[model samples]
Target: MYTTLLHQYQLTLSSRNALFDYCETVKPEDLLKPLATINNESMASLLLHVANCYVFWLANSVMQEKHAYFKGDEHLDLTAVRNVYGQVDLLMNEFLNHFKDSLDVPLLITRPDGSQLTRSPFEIFTHAITHEFHHKGQVVNMSRQLGYTPVDTDVVRE
Candidate 1:
């Protein structure tokens, strides 16, 4: 079961890299340009937001690690964005290994608002990755609005 999840996550990374490669081709200025349709969030901002979600859910919330959130404006370039993801990768590895044998075991987590929720490792992992793919689509649309054609970043290819 863990192997299956690992394989799926690997595919997710491949698709993410495809998007990152495309982001490199976008104009530096346009990468930071806020799109009205995307809640006035820039491509760079959206990318950081995706990473932040992982850190928030997986690293901070689930793993009980206190990782500082990545700020979008601070990571204006793809290189800086990549650096943030590098940290994300480390967190992901830790998350997977720590919960490999207990993917379905419910863990109680405290919310920032003093509330509590019980979630399994599998559910948290699923939520984080699916949230990522959802935002990936938004980022692609944002790129399209910036006059660049989208690339093929799906896990399955024709």
Candidate 2:
């Protein structure tokens, strides 16, 4: 199961890189341009949000680490975006390795609102990746709305 999950994550990274490649062609100002249609979030913000979610859930909540969240203003360029994801890749590796023997063990997590829930590492991993994809779709739509053509950003692109 660990090997399977690792393979899937690598595939996810490939798709994510495709998105990054598209982003590299966009001007920095455009990446930071706010779209009222998408709740005033710029493409950079959305990307940062996706990275933050992974850090929050996997690093903070699951691993009990206190890594700081990536900020949008600080990571507006493609280089910064790639650096942010480099951190995410490291975090993902640490997570998968730490839980290799206990992916299904339920662990208690506290919400920001002070509430709590028990979730297994497998469940958290699933939630994080799916949430990323959901916003990845939003990123594509936002790009289209911004007058840029969207590219294939799927795990299994044709």
Candidate 3:
């Protein structure tokens, strides 16, 4: 079961990479284009937001480690986003290495609103992965609004 969960998480990561690759093809000037989203978050902000969610859940909340993921503005270019992605990727590896054996153990996970809930490591892992895919869809929509078409990043893609 743990291996299966890990596999699912890896699939999410793979798809995320594909999404980033597609985004990289976007023109540099388009990176900060304001999307029609409610909050007016640009493509770069959306990307950075997704990237920071990983660090927030895995490093800040789950592992209880002080890992920082973002080092640039929301209008950051794709290259800066890529740099932050590498940092968050390393933090995720550390998160998995530290908690892989504790999948079934209950840990206090915190929500974005500062509320806390107790959940197993596996559950939290699944949430984080799904959360990324959910936001990825939003990113794809935003990309379309910015005049770029993104390929499918679904886990089941052939």
Candidate 4:
């Protein structure tokens, strides 16, 4: 379980990096192109949200044992959002290095509604990565709909 979870996290990181690279090649003006008529978030917004979610899960939830990261009025911008992704990625790598030998250590987590749950550090890591993948798929579809080339990020299909 530990090894499999670690591998998944690694793959998620690679996929995310690939997606970001592909997005970076896109014209800045193109990022704001309307992709959908209803419930549409720009490509930039989607990318920013993914990064924010990761940082929130890592800093507020996993590391500090606080509630979810965002409150009501958290100021978010593209540069800050991108920085969060890089920060969380580095933090996760450092964490895995330190805890690889003791992957069974239980992590105490506090839910949004003030509930408590216990899970292995591996499990929390797994959740974070999978969550990013889910959002990335949405961004990909939106990109295609907007006539942008979606990032080829599928681990198996790429």
Best by lDDT: 2
| Number of the candidate with higher lDDT, 1 or 4 | 1
TM-score of each: 0.96, 0.97, 0.86, 0.72
| Candidate 1: residue pairs that collide | none
Instruction: For residue 52, give model 1's deviation from the true position in Å.
Output: 0.7
At residue 44, give the lDDT of candidate 1: 90
TM-score of 4: 0.72
RMSD of each candidate relative to the true structure: 1.0, 0.9, 2.3, 3.8
lDDT of 4 at 110: 84
* lDDT winner between candidates 1 and 3: 1
lDDT of each: 0.91, 0.92, 0.76, 0.67
Q: What lDDT does candidate 3 reach at residue 78?
A: 79
Clash numbers, per candidate: 0, 0, 0, 0
Ranking by lDDT: 2, 1, 3, 4
Question: Residues 68-113, candidate 4, lDDT per residue (tens digit)?
Answer: 4432123243455466566667767765675677667887878668
Which residue runs of candidate 2 sit more than 4 Å off their true CA positions?
A: none
Cα lDDT of model 3 by residue, 1-158, tens digit:
65676677678778978888888888877767776573777777777887788888887888877766674464378777877877767776776677778888999877768899898877767777778788788878887887777888787786
Which scores greater on lDDT, model 3 or model 4?
A: 3
Q: Which ten residues in a row have the lowest lDDT in candidate 3?
A: 66-75
Ranking by TM-score: 2, 1, 3, 4
Worst 10 residues of 4 by lDDT: 67-76
* Higher-ranked by TM-score: 1 or 4: 1
